[model samples]
Target: MTSIGIVGSQGRMGVALAAAAAEAGHGHCGVDKDGDVGALAKEANVLVDFSSPAALEQTLDACVAQGRPIVIGTTGLEERHHYLIDDAAADIAVLQTGNTSLGVTLLAHLVREAAARLDPAFDIEIVEMHHRMKVDAPSGTALLLGQAAAEGRGIDLGDCSERGRDGVTGARGHGKIGFASLRGGTVAGDHDVIFAGPEEILTLSHRAENRMIFARGAVRAALWLLHQKPGRYTMPQVLGLGEA
Candidate 1:
């Protein structure tokens, strides 16, 4: 049985991960915010992190020091944090993503396929909603889906994407991907990718009913990462959805 250690043990995702681990018959070596992170890394077979961005660098350092694998589900990271994760992945396996739900992972894949098949005239737009407590806009998952769309259309998201438009904005530009975010209630997550054309519209969506799906997917990723060599990884690899 793999021994799992959790960071941010007191947070909502942390509690869910612990419960999911128990349900999967895995053992928890440590779960805490104040614990010796490096010690936990050394002792546990794998570490799952759903902590804050502030704790990211330190956690990556600890996992790297111990040559242990980690699955990261933290959101709202910046460029520096991504660079740090890339550096650490050279020493220890790391799987990082915005959302861990299997459905979302597959949804991203399908979005890519659809975007590739549709012409630029389809005008792709991504919309997402989360709980009011979430602070990020255009959520990490939305960006992930946008990236897939950009990849399919051979464009750069940073260069061709539009976000959070307000009044006085000009008409929608062709060949540009758009994003809209909504927050309220206790929504787990809801994402939709729409392809709008002159004649018709096609929308693809996924709604998460509970947070447990993410917890379960994170556990699955952690288990898969345990056997991988030192490198960066993604949920698509875990689910065998990589390009043929």
Candidate 2:
């Protein structure tokens, strides 16, 4: 049985992950702010971080110091945080993703495939909804789907992403991937990828009912990380959808 280390133990996802670890017949230890991160890393065989972006560096440092593999389920990360994850990945197994639910991972795969097969006349729009407490707009999962679409279309997401449109926006840019975010009552998560062609609309969606899906998926990812070499990984890889 693996000893799972939980970063942000007090958060919602952390609690769920602890329950998941127990259900999986694995032992777990957790740490929050002001806790002994290094000690936690040393005590556990692998780490799962569902913590805030601000604490990512410290969590990564502890994992690297102990040569532990980590599954990062944290959302709302910036470009700089990615650089930090990349640096740490050079020496340890790191699976970083915006969403961990297996269904969402599959949805992203399908979105990429659809984007590649459809003609440019189809306009792409991604919509996501989360709990009101969620701070990030567009949700990380939406961005993940956008990245897949961009890849299928052979374009850079940063260059073609159209978000936060308000008063007097003239027209959708050619080949733009549009995004819309909705925040409301206690939504676990919901994402829809819509492709509007000449006269038809194709929509792909995934709805998360609770935190357990993410928690269970993270455990699965951590299990995969254990046998992997030091490198960065993704949810798709965890599902064996290599390079899809």
Candidate 3:
């Protein structure tokens, strides 16, 4: 049995991960805000980190020190954090992602493919809705989708994306990807990618009914990371998309 440890045990995702681990017949340790992650790291084969961005660097440092693979689902990471993940991958397996839903991951790929095939004259927009407790706007998932769309067009996301437009926004520009965010109670997660043209509109969406979908994907990623050589990996690798 693979031993597992979860950071941010008190949060919604944490609780769900812990339960999912238990249901999978894996032993799990939960670490809260004041808990000692290093101590737990010593006992687990793999670590799942769903903690805040503020604590991410330190948490990853502890895991790296022990040479333990980790699956990170923390969002709002800066460029420096990406550098750290790349550096850590040189020593231990590290799989970091903004969203852990397998469907969403697949959706990102499809959105990229659609964006590549569709005409540039078609306007692309990504919209996501989540529970109100979420702190980030446009969501990390939405940004991931936008990034896929930008990458499909061979353009930088920062240069072509517009997020959180309000009031009398001017007419949408060509080749510019747009994002919209909505927050409410208990909504698990929902994302839609829309391609609008003068004659037709195409929409692709993924709706999460429960947090378990993400928890399951994270657990799968952690398990896969434990067997991989030290390097950066994503859900596609875990799901065998890399082989395809």
Candidate 4:
């Protein structure tokens, strides 16, 4: 059996991951915000982190020190965090994603394909809804979908995306990706990608019913990472959706 260590054990996602591990018949160790991840790392083959950005670096450091692989499901990570993951992957496997739903990962792939094939006249809009307790606007999943759309159109996201539009916003510009966010009671997650044209519109959407979707995906990713080489991987790779 694979021995797993969970960081941020007190959080919703972390607790869910712990329960999922138990349901999967895997060994698990949990560490809360003040817990020592380094000590826990020594007892497990892989670490799954669902903690905040502030705690993620320390968890990664602990995993690296123990020569253990990691699957990160945290959001709000900056570019520097990615650079650190890249550097660590040289020595141990690292899998990271904003969202861990298999369907969502597949949705991102389909969105990329659709964006690439559609005409420039198509205006792309990505909207996501999450629980009220979520602190981040434009949920990480929304950004992932937007990034996919940007990649499909062969443009940089930073150069062509508009987020959180306010009053008096004029007509949408060409080649610009738009994002909308919603927060409400107990919504696990919901994402929709709409491509609008002059006469017709096409949309793709995914709604998560439970947090188990994410927890299960993370566990599967951990299992998959055990067999892979020391390198960075994404949810698509873990689900065999495509090459990393």
Candidate 5:
């Protein structure tokens, strides 16, 4: 059994990670903010981080120091954070994802395939909803789906993504990827990608009833990381869902 380390031991996802580890028959140690991440890294065979962006630096450093693989499940990361992860990945295996649910991973795959086959007239719009406590808009899963759609359409997501439409906004642009975010009471998570074309509408969706799915997928990813060479990885790679 793997000895897992949790970097955000006090948060909701942290508690879920602990339970998932136990269910997977893995020994686990945890550390919250200002805790000794270095010590936890030393104790664990691998690490799972579901903390804020601010905590990422220390966690990656400690993992690199201890030569331990890490699964980063944190959200709301900026471009700088990815640069940090890429640097650390050169020294130790690292898996980073917006969402770790296996189902979401597959959904991204399908979105890509559909986007590739559908006509450009099929305007793609993505919608996501999460608990009221969630801070980020559009959700990371929505961005992931947007990225997948962009890839299939042979375009850059940053250039094509349309978010936060308000009054006086004109008609939706062709080939633009629209996003809508909803926040309410304790929604685990919900996502839908709609492809609107002439006389037809196609929607692909996924709903998360509980956080355990994320926890379980992350545990599986953590296990997969143990044997990977020092490098960056994605959820699709962990599950062999990437196109060959």
Candidate 6:
């Protein structure tokens, strides 16, 4: 059985991945936080991180040092962290995504295709809801959808994204992708992508009823990554849904 290590092992996602790993008959090597990331990387076949952004560099450094592949489900990452992952991918296999649900992965692909087909006349907006415990606003899944829309439109997400607006916010910009977030209760996750045109509106959505789907996807990603060459990859690639 492949040995799997969990970073942020005490968190919700970590716990889910642990249970999934056990059910998959994989070895639960160890879990780490502030103690020794490098140790877990050295001992495990692959590391699964759903940890905080503060621990990202530590985990990446350890994985690179040990030449271990990693499945990063960590959210709330910055541009610098993405750059770090890209750099590390040159040495070790790395798969990263905001959400690991296979359904969400396919949803992103659909969103991309829809965006590509629609013209600039259609306004795109992404809204997501998560549990109250989630720390990030505009949930990573929302950003993922926005990224997909931007990709289809042949624009940069950072430049086109319109995140959380407050009072005095003016009219929505043309061709801009907006985001809205809601947090309450124990909602696993819910995301909607709306494309509003002159008289017609189209919406694509995906809802997660439980965390198990994410756990299963992460494990599947880890297993596939074990045999992949050094590089950065996404869930679409792991599932062979790379083509439009």
Could you give candidate 2's per-residue lDDT for residues 106-146 as a string of tens digits?
99999999999999999999999999999888898999999
Q: How high a TM-score does candidate 6 get? A: 0.96
Clashes of 3: 0
Error of 2 at 55 (Å): 0.7
lDDT of candidate 5? Answer: 0.94
Error of 1 at 137 (Å): 1.1
Residue 50 shift from truth in candidate 6, angstroms: 0.4
In candidate 3, list every pair of residues with a backbone clash. none
- Candidate 2's C-alpha runs over 4 A off are none
lDDT accuracy of residue 112 in candidate 1: 92
Give lDDT: candidate 3, residue 75: 90
- Local distance difference test scores for all models: 0.91, 0.94, 0.88, 0.90, 0.94, 0.91
Put down candidate 3 lDDT per residue, 130-244, tens digits, no spaces: 9988888888899888988988888898989887678998988778999999999989999989999889999999999999999989998888888989988887778777721
| TM-score attained by model 5 | 0.98
- Winner on lDDT (4 vs 6): 6
What does candidate 1 score on TM? 0.97
Minimum summed lDDT over a 10-residue window in model 6 is located at 27-36
Q: After superposing candidate 3 on the true structure, give the runs of residues whose Cα lies further than 4 Å from its correct spot.
A: none
TM-score for each of the candidates: 0.97, 0.98, 0.96, 0.97, 0.98, 0.96
Error of 2 at 73 (Å): 1.0
